[model samples]
Target: MEGEAGVSVPQRSRTGLRTERLLLRQWRAEDREPFFALNADPEVMEHFPATLTREESDAFAAQSEADIDRQGWGLWAVEVAEGPDAGAFAGFVGFKVPRFDAHFMPAVEIAWRLARWSWGRGFATEAAREALDFGFTHIGFGEVVSFTAVPNVRSQAVMRRLGMTHDPDDDFDHPVLPEGHRLRRHVLYRARSAA
Candidate 1:
């Protein structure tokens, strides 16, 4: 459950499969510092619990790597394919199995986390499109889903761009979080196969 236990497709990078602007690749040991910085950013973590510590980031990165080995996909260190941060870690995008408390009808989800500096630039949408393509096409999943805190308009917008439709009725109080957590009320989005 700690690693990429439910990813059905073989993917190496969290950056993305590749678009004109981004390279979705797996995380490298060298990415730990920037990865940690992004995770520790308050604005970026605004929708989650408090920012992660460097140690927590390091441990998570290590586990992400293990997840790729186990399920062939997990969050990756994202960077521009050709830009100042092309080789640097900008953030991450990937897929994982939801914990039981996630209450997602589809059970598996495509997820992302990028630095504040990378926000509002279309990077999340682009990278996430690749993940959806991988999930629905190569991975042969019947559906793919995403979720976020009700106030996370940014991520919700990206989900819309990816053609995921909101199912407000699917919203639930996230069970894993403490009662009344500001981020506990979550909304679900879903996309089904073209086939």
Candidate 2:
């Protein structure tokens, strides 16, 4: 189906979406271990305050699944849809509503967290493009935003590749982070619906 932006909408099922190379779907029992590893990897969690413990990782996954179940969309677990690693749990890529209030609160954010092996590939950008399309076309959101710590140029590059624009004026200190924290100041990027 054609969306308001005249872009072809991706095929979607309840709690799932398919891109050219990735499947954004609900969390699975098999995804727990790898997800925990991803969250615990200091390299992966470097942009955040700290790595997640196994329990914390599991709880986050459980909440993501429940969010998908209740709203038909949330942070969907991503899997390689085709290739040698087909069906392998890579990580997650999808939408999230930031719980804390900020100048950008009450907005949906496009985000991703992929395993280290998935880096250097176009998976994050590809999956995030589909998620953005779903949000604009299916959810009918007028805009979606993404943000990261000032040092996270990698994620900012993904946002830029997705056509999201960044404005220095829109930057804000993350409310959840303590004042003076290294990751407290964040750069916000926004993508507006073509409709």
Candidate 3:
């Protein structure tokens, strides 16, 4: 919720720390346009079913805000602080409460998504590692999970890079997706806090 009155972007971290090149922080209203652009990219949507419509993007952005308001934890937009695209929404990395399928119990999940332009730059791994640190250290989540379609090898690679181990037996069809959805076949990975 609103921790303080009239706070523009929420006081979670006014100017968050940097991680080499990327700046991981809270989302702003102005980020909607770039976020929508990234979400609508065909190449970026290749792993998923299809590109998200503008309306869908807007609703997703609104839901992200509502998620932070309700849970105090949600995906934070990522940007390169000193790059040409500085201040632009590169993508997001954070933890979310996902509705797990029957094969695996519900759990907190660490997720990441970067623009097509941001791919192959280690942005996803770096940001996701920080989000995992935040989730396990700061948020006190016992274990953080991530999932992707069976064919989404790139994302699975990132999860592996983040030190998550696969549990193929935990794989299941995505519950929210249609029965025959192409992206419905999913795999699970989990990383537990050392402490």
Candidate 4:
């Protein structure tokens, strides 16, 4: 399926979603190396509490792979589909169910984390739009939400580009983080299915 600007909608296969420039597919063994690199990069992990160790990153990838195997959708490993970087592991852009309890518990979040090299090319927004489409059309989600620390303007901008709306009243401190943590206060954005 195609969306605005010729972006392909996500297919409900284990292969996962696709867009004009990305293939949001299941994680691969080869992806672990670069995935760990990105996860360990302090710049890339700036918004999060800390960089992930190799074991943490591998476990994350393993869980992502298992999720796709069982549910046919999860945090997909994003691959560059064309150009000189074709087939490169740019990073991930897909849906995740927040494990922590919050007012928004039970919501599926549209999220992305790309390599520093992939920044500024609209990859996150492009792949996320396709993932959001999949969540609405394929998974039957009435509304999908995204949240990030208050300082994460970049992600918030991507959220806006996806036509998601932010309501300050809906914002809340992340329950996963301890009180007084700098990253605990997060901004929430929501988008409802057009259907």
Candidate 5:
């Protein structure tokens, strides 16, 4: 709503964001444990090769913090609104430029990763929509893209819900993953800006 003059709600800055049922905000001290646990969960990391160690998790959190501080936007720490899980550390959703070359370099990728409990609640989709809104309407990005291992049906479903369309022609092997890794081959999905 900040796009229109005098209409409120500032564009999401490095601080964070809020949706109808969630908060796509910044890192908090208390979020470390659950965030680490979420990253360590085998089921949660199933699409990827392995779960991260606590040190790796901490490093990721630190990197996420720095990215937002330096770039004004990055994966945001999320919190759900009032409910049993109210004020709880849910997960993150937002934008980041991938650090590798693919057929699709120099692109903004919208992503989400929530705790197991946060699943089935639509929080990923909700927070992602807010992030995309910020990217397109507030930041004026022309298009945003997402990619995942072909087996990650759930994330693909969320991408579809956000109006992203997949084209098999854009699929490519994720450069960062080790060669021959099952998840290296990924499907790309794209969405035009809402602005």
Candidate 6:
């Protein structure tokens, strides 16, 4: 887990955004296994359709890195910068552009995919607030959005905690899911930049 374990030397990223408890740094080669562990955890991936194979997880991580390298910002491969989990790869929390077409076609989105051990603590919320600040302040985004199946209350709670608003009108059937799939119907939430 070379780079995946928490390293305390203040590992900075091309997309440098850090919170008091976490560092939203760029992805590293070492992140692969921990990421696979997160993806393979059924509880962590319950909101998703199924667990990803190691190859799929690696591909997903590669794509995330490419987005960061190309756009200068994407899902930040987060590390717990301090505390017991310090230097451990907690997971990712940052910005992304959903390529799928929908009513919210051109909006930037804030997202997270953290390891199960990182759940109870406020890491996701903590890191996400910084990501929101960076997106709204530095990146000049007007608004950011998040969505999950209606039953995904945990993530929705994070959205609400971020001061995002939801409207029934924004609820949508996920275009990527099959028509009757359980996770197909998603609730959308939006947050505006404080700027």
**What is the C-alpha local distance difference test score of each model?**
0.78, 0.89, 0.77, 0.87, 0.84, 0.84
TM-score of every candidate relative to the true structure: 0.89, 0.93, 0.86, 0.92, 0.91, 0.91
Clashing pairs in 2: none
| Candidate 4 Cα deviation (angstroms), residue 16 | 2.5
Pick by lDDT: 2 or 6, better one: 2
Cα deviation of 92, candidate 6, in Å:
0.5
Instruction: Report the CA-based lDDT of candidate 4 relative to the real structure.
Output: 0.87
Q: Model 4 Cα displacement at 8 (Å)? A: 20
RMSD of each: 3.1, 4.0, 4.3, 4.9, 4.1, 6.3
Runs off by more than 4 Å, candidate 1: 1-16
Model 2: runs farther than 4 Å from truth?
1-15
Candidate 1 — what's its lDDT? Answer: 0.78
**Per-candidate clash tally:** 7, 0, 0, 0, 0, 4
Residue-level lDDT tens digits of model 4 in 80-122: 9989999899999877778888887788888899999999999
- Local lDDT at 135 for model 5: 80
For candidate 2, write residues 120-192 as lDDT tens digits.
Answer: 8899999999988888877777889999999999999999999999999999999999999999999999999
* Model 3 C-alpha lDDT versus the unseen true structure: 0.77
Full candidate order by lDDT, most accurate first: 2, 4, 6, 5, 1, 3
| Model 6 C-alpha lDDT versus the unseen true structure | 0.84
> After superposing candidate 4, which stretches have Cα over 4 Å from the reference?
1-11
**lDDT for each residue of candidate 5 in 56-159, tens digit (9 for 90 to 100):** 99898888877776666788899887688788998788888888988888888898889998899888888899888888776667889999998999999999
Model 5: runs farther than 4 Å from truth?
1-11
